[model samples]
Target: MAVVGGGIGGLAAALALSRAGHDVRVFEQARAVSEVGAGIQLAPNATRVLRDLGVLAEIERVAVRPEVFEFRRWDDGRLLSSTPLGAAIEQTYGAPYLHVHRADLVRVLAGAFPAERVAVGRRCVGAVRRPDGAEVRFADGSGTAADVVVGADGIHSAVRASLFGARAARFTGYVAYRGLVPAQRVAGLGLGRRSTVDLGPGAHLVHYFVAAGRLLNVVCVLEESSWTREAWTDPGDPAELRAAFTGWHPTVRGVVEALDHPLKWALFDREPLPEWGAGAVTLVGDACHPMLPYAAQGAGQAVEDAAALAACLTGASAADVPAALARYAELRLPRTTRVQGMSRDNGTRFHLPDGPDQLARDEVMAAAFGLSPDIDWLYGHPVPASSSGGREGARRG
Candidate 1:
């Protein structure tokens, strides 16, 4: 198996397949594997998959386990709701919600695979499927044929364009500024130890500790008419960011003010693809269905995809590859599509304008956070067992 794009999804697919006793090679366009941002929230579903893959212990060492997720008003720091996540979530879901540095998680996955198996700077130009296998061509005028090709390239996937042709990604009309500050620095500002979301009129601020409380990751998303660029590493003007949340709560301003250098990303998402597999090739992660950050499941869903793909392909014959790929798609498509829709809906709900609706939303959140079952469907559900082979897949599914 050959996995394209050495981001988290690609590396994860390579690791999972190799662990399943297959020879897998991962091709990454970057010179090295490194994440651009500060933090990623790994809900229980994703953590359980990683735990099964045998990387959970290493992840836990560097990840922060927050006790609660608190939502507050942007104007006066009034607490609207708080969801208990540490013990309650683990007891219900079978795993803890982990907040870790993106780079740390990438390192964990990359280290699990043999160094030589990951070919960096090998940009995938296109791929062609044959009766026997699939041929992947790289921009450096080289090619490799493998029994299966997985396109985990992400939202701007080259393999996706080569297969489905070019389709514009819908801009959500929002720009996000993200940065990480030393936790000690945040503490000096008198900010308490907690995960916080300050909901304002047209924007919101999410702050949380990561890297086991060594650093605080801050993300601020605001509605905008146009974007300067789409890159996650684009330089952002802190002054502009401060101005956007000018009159926000003092805590919100303190989090933004603690930033040294911040990067801005123009948020965009796509409707779920009608198909994820073609011949001996299939797509995973953002390449198949990109979602907004509201649900904090963009990376989580990709990790889920990797686990499902590995489960479907394990112990399958060459003739069974197509059926396996279809089964993977059939199992993942509906769930991811629902998540994508929910993320969009949550974005609107979070940025609701002032009215009875906003008041009602606040009331609902205040009440929902107190209940254990209100969020069980999201944080407690496990991935369904794979159904490729009758009993074996069922056991792992």
Candidate 2:
């Protein structure tokens, strides 16, 4: 099998398929396989898959276990809602919820994936289905054929574009600034081992412990009527960041001020595709369903997609590849689509102006505080995996 893009979803898919006793290779666009981001929240839905992949323990070693997730009013710093998330969540969900630096998580996954099978600097241009299987084409004037080709490539996936025509992503008119602040710098402020978000009109700020509580990851999102930039690597002006949060709580302002450099990127998500793939070629992760960051399930959903794809493909023969890909899509599409919608809805609620609707939203949240059942579909769901190495195609090497 050929997997395009060695990102979290791609690596997880390769690892899951390998453990299910299949041979897979991961092709990464960059010269080196690394992740560049602030932090990622591994809700139980994701940690369960990482545990099954056998990397959750290593990940937890460098990750922080937040005791609670809370929301507060932006101006007055009044707590609006709080949910317990440490031991209680682990017991109920069958996995731990964690916050880890993106680089650390990628390092652990790369360590587990077979290095020789991973080829960096190979940018996949597109893919085409053959009678027997599928062929993946690269920008380097090279191509490879496999029984199945998976496009784990991200939002602008070339494979997706190749199978389905090009479609532009809809920008949400929101830009996010992300940075990590040394925990010690904010020690005096008493920011505990918990995830917190300050909600305000037209904007919101989230901060949580990561890197075993050594750093606090801060993500501030603001709505802009006229600003339209999309690059993810653009350096943000700290002055502008501070100015944006001028009237926010002191703690919120302090977090922004401590960041020496923050990455600013316009938020964009595509409408879910009617179908995830065709023939023996299929997509996983953001390639198929991209969601806003409001729900913090972007990474979690991608992890789930990997596990589902592996489950559907295990025990299938070369002739069964197309059916397996189709099954993978059938299993994942609804869940990811629902999540995409939920994330979009949350984005709208987070930026609601101070009005009756905002007050009603706050009341609903406060009333639902500490109710894990409300999110059971999200945190309590499990991704299917093969208990034994699958049928005739099982390759133990």
Candidate 3:
């Protein structure tokens, strides 16, 4: 198997497949397979999958387990709702909720996978479905053929374009600014080990601890009328960010003040594809279903995709490769489509202007605080099991 793109999802796929006794290689475009300085939230749904992958111990070493997820009003700093997450979530879901720096997670995943199997600096230009199997063409005048090819490349996926033409991602009229600061700098604000979101009209702010409580990850998203550059490393103006959240709560203001260098990006997501792949090739993660960050399940769903793909292909013959890929898609599509919609809807709900509708929403949130059934379907669910029996695949040999 050949996996394209070495981001979190791609590496996770490669690791899972290799662990299942398949010879897998990863093609990464970057010279180094490291992520940027952002934080990722791993709900139980994600941690369960990670635990099964046998890397949860290493991940826990660098991850901070948040005690709770608290939502508050942006202006007055009133707690709207609180969801217990530390031990309570683990007891219910059989996994911990964690916050880890993106780069640290990538390092851990890459370390678990063999170094020689990952080919960096190899950019995938396109892919084709050959009679025997599939082939991935690279920009370096090279190619790799495999019994199955997985496209875990992100939103601008070249393999996806090669299979299903390029489509423009719909802009969500929102821009996000992210920054990381030492936790000590914000200690005066009394922020603890919790995932907090401050909701206001037309914008929201989220902050939590990462890197084992040494660093704080701050993200602010606001409605933008015009800007549409979808790059993640674009420079953002702290002054502009501060001005946008001028009347926000003091805690939010303090986080903004501690920002040293913030990166900004416009939020965009594609409509779910009718079908993820064709023949011996399939797509995973953002390549198949990109969603807004409002729900914080982007990475989690990708990890879930990795697990399901590996499960479906665990013991399939070369002739069964296409069927295995389809089974993976069938197991993942509905859930990812639902999550994509949930993330999109949360964008609207979080940015509602203070009025009757907002008041009603707040009332509901306040009443249903703590382990509400509303999210049980999301965080409480496990990866769908593959129905394939214990037949060894000829391709694995």
Candidate 3 stretches greater than 4 Å from native: 228-232, 384-391
Q: Which stretches of candidate 2 lie over 4 Å from their true place?
A: 226-230, 372-374, 395-397
Query: Comparing candidate 1 with candidate 3, which one achieves the higher TM-score?
Result: 3
Candidate 2 accuracy as TM-score: 0.97
Q: What is the TM-score of each candidate against the true structure?
A: 0.94, 0.97, 0.97
RMSD of each: 3.1, 1.5, 1.8
Q: How many steric clashes between backbone atoms does each model show?
A: 2, 0, 0
Global lDDT of model 2? 0.88
lDDT (Cα, 0-100) at 195 in candidate 2 = 91
Expressed as tens digits, the lDDT of each residue in 39-60 for candidate 2 is: 9899999999999999999999
Each model's C-alpha lDDT? Answer: 0.83, 0.88, 0.89
